[model samples]
Target: MHASREPASRSVVSDVVADCLADIDRIAREYLLEVQKIDDYAGSAVVAQDLEETAVASMELLLRLVGNLPIPDRLAGVSEALGHRRAQQGLPLESLLRAVRMDFRILWTAMLEKVPAEFLPDFTQDAVRVWEAVEFHTIRVHAGYLNELATMAQEKETQRAFLLSRLINSEGKDPQLLGQAARALGVKPESSFIVAVAAGHAQKAFRAGVLRAGVGQFLHERDGALILILEDVPARARREPEGTRAWLAALDCFVAPPARSLAAVPPMLRIALESLPVVTPDRPGQRTVRDAWGYVAATRLGEYGTVLADTVLGPLATISAHERDRLIDTVQAYLRSGSVSETAAELYCHRNTVLNRLARFEQLTSFDPANPQDAATVIAALHVHFLRR
Candidate 1:
C-alpha cells in the first residue's frame, strides 16, 4: 500500500506541472494575440494597455504554478523582451500598467480552476510587482521614440521653407539648379508660367500654393521688384477686350489696391527690363539676355508709354479741334488738286473760307498750304495727333 501511494503522488505532481505550463502558455499566447489586434485597432493605445493587463495575468499564473519549483532566471528574460518591444513605440506608461494588472487578474482566475484558491491570491500579488517594473521601463522607451519623431518633423519643415524662399528669389538663376532644389523640397514646377509681382495692399492677399514676389508702380518695372511665377490661362470671351479703351481697362484691372501694377511675362519683357533696372537697383548689371520674351516686354512697354504720354499731353495741343479738322481736310484736298472748289467742298466751307483756313493751318503747323510736300506734312501731323488722344 505504501509503494502504490508513492507512485500516485508522483503522477499527481507531474499532472499539475504539465497543466500549469499548458495554462500559462495558452494565456500568454492569447494575450500576445490580443495585443497585436489592439495594435491594429482604432484607439490602439487603449488596446495596448488592455493587452499588457492580459500578459501580467498570464505571468502571475505562471509564477504561482511554478512557485515550489523556485524562481528561475528565465523570468527576467520575459521582462527584457517586453522592454525591447515597448522601446519601439510611444504608448503611455499608464496604459501598460493597467494592461499588466488586467493580464495578472485573468491568469489568477484561470489558475483558480486547478490551483488551490487560497494560494492564487498570494501568487498573483507577488508576481504583480515584477510586471510593474517591466511596464514602467516600456513606457519610458515609448515616450523617447515619440520625442525624437517630433523633432525630426520640425526640422524638415524649417528646411523646406528656407529652400523655397531661395528658389523664388534667385532670378536668371540656372533652371537645372532650381529644379534640383525644388525636387529636394518636393515642389513641382508648373509649365508655361507668368511671373507676377504684386505690391501695396495686394501683399496681404493670401492664397495657398501661390508664391509671392515684390513689385513696383509701373507695369513694366513691377516684375523687377518682387516676382512670383504661376501658371497662365488663356483669356476667355468675357475677359477679352478690343480697342484702346479695352487695353486701358485691362491695365487698370491688374493695378489693384494691393498691387501698383502687374505685367504678363515674356509678352511684356521690354517694359520689365526697364522697370527691373529701377526695381532692382541693387543689381544693375544683370540685363544682357534677350529673347522672345524680351521682345514682347519691349512692345508692351512701348504701348504703355505711348498711352501715358498721350493721356498727359493730347488735350493740350496748340491746334483747336475745329481748326485741326479743317486743316487736315484742306491739306488732303489741296494735295489731291490745285482745285479750290474741291478743297472748299471737302472742308464744308466756301472757297475763300477754305483759303483762309488753309493759311491759318500753315501758320500754326509751320507747313506751306500750297506746297505738296508741306501739305503732306500737315496731313501726317493731323493723323498722328488724332491717334494720340
Candidate 2:
C-alpha cells in the first residue's frame, strides 16, 4: 500500500517514522511483552527466538513500507519460514495469526511515541494506509501458513505409509520392529488388532469411511486388494453400532479374528488375505476368519485336499441338494456340540432326528462326524466341498 498520494506530507511523515528506527529494538521488545500476555510464546524455547524475530521483522517491514523504500526479500522469506517451522512443530496456526494481527496496533503505538507533535497531522492521515499494509502482510502470513500445513500433512502421510509397510511386510520374528512401528503410529504394542482385506476398487471409499469409524489404524492397498488394520472401537462407535456395523457390512472383505498383540498381527494379516476368496457377499458386520479357517487351510492343501473332498463327499452329490444340506448341517452341529441331544436342541428338532442324520452321514461317507478320531477328516472334506461349491 502506498503511504500517500499526497507525496510531500506523506514523505515528511515517512521521514519522521524513518528517524524512529533507532528505537526499533525497544519497540520490538515492547511488542513481545504485549503479545506474551495473550500467549506465553516463550514457553517453547524452540520458538522463543522466533517471537523476537517476528516482532522485529514486522516493525522493519512496516517501517520500510511507510518510507516507500524497497522492502527486502528476506522480510517475506522470514514470514514464510515462520509458517513452515511452526507447522513442522505441529503447533496451531491460530497463535501466529493472532500475533500477526497485533502488528498494526503496535506500529501505531510506536509512531505515536516517536513522531514529533508537529508531525501528528501528517502521520494521522496514514491511519487507513498503514492498516492496509498490515492487512497485506497478514495475507502473506496466511498464504505461508496454509502452504506449510499442506506440506506437513503430506510428509506425515508418507511417514505413516512407510511405517504401515514395515508392519505388514516385516517377518514375525522381529518383535522390536513391530514395537517401533507401533510407537511411530501411536498405537500400543500390546493392543488387540484385527486385519482386513477388501477389493482394491474399494480403497478410496474405505479410506473415507475409516476416518469416521475411528477404528482402523493402518491402511494400504497392495496388488488387487486393500489391507486395513483395526484397533479399538471408540465408545461413540459402540453406541451407534449400526453406523459402524453398516460401514463394515458394506466392506465386502475378510477380517481376521482379533490378535492380542502386534507380534500376532502378521499371522492375522495372512489369514485375512487367505480368507478373501471364501468371503461371501456382504458377510455383514464384524465377520472373521474363524468360520473360514477350514476353507483357507483347504485352499493351501491343493490337490491333496481336492482328493479328500472327492473321496469323502463325492457320495453326497448323488443325493438331492436339500438332503445333502440337511445332513451336512446336522453333522456340523453334532461335531460342534459333541452331544446328539444338544445338537437336536440347537437345530430345533427331536433328539432322534439328530441321530438319524449322523448315522446317514456316516453310512454314505464312512466317517462319523460324532467320532472324535474321524471328525477332523470329516470337517476337512466338508470344507473342501464347500469351497468347491
TM-score of each: 0.29, 0.76
lDDT of 2 by residue, 1-389 (tens): 56236767766666667865767888899888877875536454446577787778878877776666787778857666766766666556787778778888888887777667887776687777668777777777778889988887688777777776777787656877887777766677766665677644455666776767875556665556777766544223433212124576666666777666676677888777777765554443345666678877888888999999899888998899999999999998887779988999999999999889989988998898867779999888878887777
Error of 2 at 189 (Å): 2.3
Runs with alpha carbons beyond 4 Å of true place in candidate 1: 1-28, 39-116, 123-131, 158-389
- Compose the digit string of candidate 1's lDDT tens values, residues 1-389: 01122454344434444565666656676666644544333354435464555365436434543333444565434543443344334454455444444454544444456645555544444344334433443454345445555665567655654554454445424566456544543433422333333332233341111322222211221322433333332233233222111222212112111111112233333243333322122332222223123323434445564554344334336767676665666766876677889877776779998788677765655567588776544444443344444
Q: Judged by lDDT, which candidate is best?
A: 2
Model 2: clashing residue pairs?
none
Clashes of 2: 0
- Candidate 1 C-alpha error for residue 193, in Å: 12
- Cα-based lDDT for every prediction: 0.44, 0.73
RMSD of 1: 17.7
